[model samples]
Target: MGQLPTDVPWDVNWDKKFESQLEELKQSGSFDTYRKKTIRIIRNPIREGSYKSENLKGLKTAHVSGNYQDIICFELTPGVNHQSQQEKLEEVYLHFIDHWDNYDSALSSRNAAGRTVEFTIEMPYLEEGYDVERAKNTVYKAVKDLDGSRITQEWGDECLRLTGEVSPEDKDVVKTAIPTTVDVKFNENTLF
Candidate 1:
């Protein structure tokens, strides 16, 4: 488990994939009320509408605003050792933001197009003092060894995202390439 900083306002950040989705929402003008509401989620996490996610332990989801069509998924870390009496979290990591209706579809992508499938490896951003440099070096080394694979890591505020394509044969290689300490997720439909 990783600990979060005790900084005020709880540093909030998102990954590239989430940013891409957010950009689409911004362009379509659907996120007008989302920005302010997100601040609320970061400031106060255990509010009425927010719910502890069943599948993703330690994470939660809450609507951006009242009856809003957008949803925000984030992980909130509490202050160290319950030293403070207040209920404020030390950090808020934005995992994703999407139209409420697209969740079902987002979880339903077809089999990953092996030989050309793009992979994104995500690892939570831990508080400083963690071996971040060594971890990065390990990933870089593995990426270098990948033959014909074009994987790149894009670090995010919430999670480190490594996005790139791998061939069918190299797909399995990817599984072994990244360390088991890293957490990787694909659409629900993806088997590998």
Candidate 2:
């Protein structure tokens, strides 16, 4: 089995499909954004609630990206050395940077290596006059009831932004729970 170095300059093993997807990102003008996000993730893979990083529930994998347009998914495997009694961890694999539109299908058909699927929802900027904390808690509870993970509540543009991962079937439950006046929007990754 492979072992990851514990110190600086951590190991990162990229999957075979990553190269082609990277080249495509470059051609499409998202390379710069993707590069920055990737670097941030590599520097601190374990950080939680980051706007640029998220933990996918079902797949047992984490992804780093900006605007949710392009995603770089990876899995961290833990290992223990019995003889030396030392704990070790490795970012066993870095999957391809999948586009949002194809992410679901690719994730469904591809080999998850025992990882499951998770549906992420982003609700950005609630309308004025709504209690931000109350609204966030309500949505958070709704998602939690459905077994969601990586729930985050933050303030953006002076308004509340909530993001979390849930099962595909439970997406409607959370959506319906939000008040119509809030203008909840999903991250479709379309610039137009």
Candidate 3:
């Protein structure tokens, strides 16, 4: 998926009529201050304006910076109806990339540094047995999306478990997406 207009940093496109006004600000040097303020807001929006005190979880905020004709604006609203868990998760993933440095999406209760996710799938319902290997790969992909690394994968029949100290994120997404993405009846063993 690509940017959905709801993504962060924002897009600012000034009107053609304002070219002269913009130039005037540049000539007067006041534009430099506005420009820096705009840039700062774009770079780390959550740490700016109203959001300076809060963190994120696919939740976004807005700001209208600068004055009169020189005004620049931004607003973000989550999708009208994220029909699928993946779509909701993809949105979260976008934010996940934005605040990767400042936030932790996955925090294991077992330890400060480790995250654990486990799932088991039973395929006896299918006349043709399901691919256990695909299930393994699915677990790996989910773990990777969680930012999991140095993982310890233990596979049994149709089950997979992961645990390690790799500072990952997206645990909330994992809860819904993993089971749905794998398209299997899943029994979640654990998640962090």
Error of 2 at 162 (Å): 0.8
Candidate 1: minimum summed lDDT over ten consecutive residues — where?
A: 106-115
lDDT per residue, candidate 3, 1-192, as tens digits? 121233423443423454335446556766445343332222223323333322221222222111011112232223323223222222211221122121122111111222323333332223244454565566556656444333355654545444332232444444443444344322222211
Q: Which candidate leads in lDDT?
A: 1
What are the clashing pairs of model 3? none
Model 2 scores a TM of 0.34
| Per-residue lDDT of candidate 2, residues 1-192 (tens digit) | 122234323344434454446557666777556454433333223322331224332222334322232333333344422213222443333334444344334332322221222334334454565556666778877777553234666666655666655544565766776765665544422111
The better-scoring model by lDDT among 1 and 2 is 1
Error of 3 at 159 (Å): 4.5
Q: Is candidate 1 or candidate 3 better by TM-score?
A: 1
Which residue runs does candidate 3 get wrong by more than 4 Å? 1-130, 148-150, 157-169, 177-192
Candidate RMSDs in Å, in order, are 17.2, 15.3, 17.2
Quantify how close model 1 is to the true structure by its C-alpha RMSD in Å.
17.2
Clashing residue pairs in candidate 2 (N, C-alpha, C atoms within 3 angstroms): 58-116, 59-116
TM-score of each: 0.32, 0.34, 0.23
lDDT of each: 0.44, 0.43, 0.32
TM-score-wise, the better of 2 and 3 is 2
- Which TM-score value belongs to model 1? 0.32
